[model samples]
Target: MSSPGFKADAAAMTRAVQGFEECAANAKKTMSDLENDLVSALSHYQGSQATAFWQLHTQLQDKMRVASSELDTMSNLVNQSFHNYGSGDSTVAQSLTSLSNNVDAGGAVFGRLTGA
Candidate 1:
């Protein structure tokens, strides 16, 4: 039977990871900018209404941070998977090559002994 094979578009995977990382970075930057703007706009405000608004905003920001973190983690995982697959594929190929070489040498020795 033929050896199993693996094929992947490494360039596409790379681009996907890059895109995820960029999105994460953008999310973080946007959150920071939003926070700055909110603080500036609310600086002159006061009262329980403002406090409630800030609390809600904080919760929203926390969720956004989580999302951004998740994106970054996803990107890292994809990149890691790509590398691992590549390494595993190379190892399998080398093992197959070595096994084939050994079989060839054995066959040659057998032929010599049998005068074939």
Candidate 2:
């Protein structure tokens, strides 16, 4: 007996991909904006504290870049998954349709073992 087949929610997968992409874009924009604001704010004052602040800013910027890249990777992965799921669903549907056609043509759904 055949059981119910797999059901994929393309809309949900698309939304997830979009969400990741949006998050990456937001991260990039936030980092850029913050960097600009910090640069404007620290335009003057030469001191050890200013040097340390710049170092910290660089580190933060690097971290944010990494985060954005990771988010983009995730989005790509989800998008790939969506395509894979669609392909798999198509394969299964085709196989089932072939099977139904065979059965309709009076072919056995299951082959019996002659030795058994």
Candidate 3:
């Protein structure tokens, strides 16, 4: 038979083991919660970043379209002016000069639109 003192020590040891198990379980749960929170925060950040990038891309595309149209108009006007000059018509020459001025104005507008 075990001595009374030895029985008491054994009981104390059992209590200590139970306490350690409880603490370990709590720590594990806390770590899991922290991991989940980190993942959620990262997902939110990625979503926000994607939205911003798409918005910027759309705005850039719109600007590019406007710039392209302006360039096309200018090219057409210049071509018309050259054709008029070749035709040796004084009235056409005057018209060509007006168109050239318009082209210059459009160029300035395009530049402003492109932030250039």
For candidate 3, write residues 1-116 as lDDT tens digits. 44566557656655655565565556556655655565454455557786775565566556655655665565566556555443444555578899998878899787888897
Q: Global lDDT of each model?
A: 0.76, 0.74, 0.61
In lDDT terms, which candidate is top? 1
TM-score for all models, in order of appearance: 0.70, 0.70, 0.39
How much is the lDDT of residue 20 in candidate 1? 71
Which lDDT tens digits does candidate 1 get at residues 35-94? 788778777667987898788778877887787778778877877987886677678778
The clash count of every prediction, one per candidate, is 0, 0, 0
- Residue pair clashes in candidate 2: none
What root-mean-square deviation over C-alphas does model 1 reach? Answer: 5.0
Model 1: lDDT equals 0.76
Candidate 3: regions farther than 4 A off: 47-116
Q: Rank the candidates by TM-score, best first.
A: 1, 2, 3
